[model samples]
Target chain A: MNPEKVNLEQKLSRFDEHWSPKVVGELNGQHVKLVKLLGEFVWHHHDEEDELFLVVGGRFRMEYRDREEWIEPGEFVVVPRGVEHRPVAEEEAHVMLFEPASTVNTGSAGGGMTVADLDRI
Target chain B: MNPEKVNLEQKLSRFDEHWSPKVVGELNGQHVKLVKLLGEFVWHHHDEEDELFLVVGGRFRMEYRDREEWIEPGEFVVVPRGVEHRPVAEEEAHVMLFEPASTVNTGSAGGGMTVADLDRI
Candidate 1:
């Protein structure tokens, strides 16, 4: 095992993609990913996996079917499995996600924005 | 679903006990815990669970038999299963943990510091 810790900021700095998530750390079959969000992401739902989003900087608005909740920096929200949701950000938002390693960025919704394979930073 | 975001700083402000992790969120059978650390914790290893420690504030030192790693704010470390490790902090450190819900703080080594049940904040 590598003795060095994974510096999240250093990892985040290497990528500039708006929706692409870069894997930084993993444990217990879960992956910790860093991503920057701008505009609205695809509305999707993971049938078997739940997702956790932590805002590191800026604000993120989680758009559910019924309502929308804004998450400020240092706040987090958990989207349960099978719950359709979308992340919308007016400005660039630095975020961290904790979810299963098998989770796809677009979930079951296959589209142009779907990222089947994610990059590791 | 609550549709409300969990403010990490707000939850952190509610607890002052070190080593005792309070559950702030849960998804996919995994719990997101917040804890404060000061001084050295027990040397133990999880048999089936891998622990993820993300330093939210201050510095945290992970002690292993081979080497020591210092995790700074916005950094994280993954301690794999069956690896003996301990956390040492000279000053107060705020940390977030992402792991399975069944993971015990003391791992398989039970003692006074073992928290069988965690409180939600």
Candidate 2:
């Protein structure tokens, strides 16, 4: 009752940086984040967390060690813990990520795109 | 990588039961469920689990003791644990719910509408 409703489109419009996830909602010790993705991300794996990527706009490609899948809008793919993966977007893609509050964007493969400190919108 | 991609619309089409939630995906000890709602739901509260309701198609309403909010497509609302709430949908509304695997559709308010054993889609 206290928390307000969140609109995905309105939340997506507040940021533009690629791979930078902004926390939009939190529940059950998990943070629901919104990230605008473009190009290819660093290959990484969350040693302690499983990440759920739901495409809100455009398309997202989840590349695993064995295969890759294209996730269109309204579709989601879950990358389980300890599984190496990378996300690639041909164009600007709006993604909603669900994971623990401690999850990092780059995961174990920290790089320039690593967002250690995320801001809640 | 072991988990498959889930399409919201495709999953919603598999069931037509009202107030009954079907699990579509699971991650990090949580379950992603889809339920179609019509009319009003029982007032209930989850003592230990927070519930997130994300509207995928049509519209929904989250009614609390004091106020209520209309949730349209692309909108979501998080009802914290122990907060009494009820969902109302004048028309058929497709919703995606994210909560712990132990969550029951009726919460603490058990009745004929309570679905204890949910089927996975």
Candidate 3:
């Protein structure tokens, strides 16, 4: 087994595209992904998987059905399964996502923003 | 459902004890824990669960069976199940752990450093 250390900053630097998630690491059937966000993401809900969003840089507002939460650097927000939410960022935001390997970016509301093939950074 | 944002820095500030882990959040049956580590830790290995060590502050060296890996801030190391490892920190190090809710601090080598009841920050 390769016990290499995964550097978040280095992996994040490898990509520059927004909304496209690049896999940084994997453990226990979960994929740790790095993504750049700008503007607004589509409202979607995952029926069977919860998603964790950890802000690496910048800030973003996560809008839920009943309320909105601001996630800044070093902060994280967990969107539970089956809950509708949208992430909006004024500036470029770097985020690390932890979820099951089978989880899709657009969830059940898959459309053009849906990324089927994620590149491993 | 409480869709609260977890501030890692704030959660880490709430505890100062070394080797003790405080839960910050939970998702998909896994607990996100913040722990302060100082000095050397006991060598142990989980029989059935893999562990993720994400360095939030300071630095530490993870001693594995064959080699030692130095983990610094913004770097993460994953220890696979049943792999013998020990974590050592020259100075105070803050880390965020992601593992199953039932994961024990001491793993199979339970001793005085073993913490059973982890406080939720």
> What is the lDDT ranking, best to worst?
3, 2, 1
Instruction: Give one digit per residue, the lDDT tens place, for model 1 in A1-121.
Output: 7446887778888988899998888888888999999999999999999899999889989999999999998999988889999999999999999999999989888799988788887
**Candidate 1 chain A, run of 10 with poorest lDDT:** A1-10
Error at B19, model 2, angstroms: 0.8
Best by TM-score: 2
At residue B111, what lDDT does model 2 achieve? Answer: 92
Instruction: Indicate the worst ten consecutive residues by lDDT in candidate 3 chain B.
Output: B7-16
User: Candidate 1 clashing pairs?
Assistant: none
What's candidate 3's DockQ score? 0.80
True contacts kept of 1: 0.77
* Residues A1-121, model 2: lDDT tens digits: 2768999999888877888899999999999999999999999999999899999899988888888889999999888999999999999899999999889888899989888889989
The CA lDDT at A102 in model 1 is: 91
Which model is ahead, 1 or 2, in terms of lDDT?
A: 2
Docking class of 2: high
lDDT (tens digit, per residue) of candidate 2 on B1-121: 2668999888988888898999988889999999999999999999999999999999988899999999999999999999999999999999999999999888899998998899999
**Docking quality level of the chain pair in candidate 3:** medium
Model 1 deviation from the true structure expressed as Cα RMSD, one decimal place = 1.2
Give each model's whole-structure lDDT.
Answer: 0.90, 0.91, 0.92
Error of 3 at B46 (Å): 0.9
Stretches off by above 4 angstroms in model 1 are none
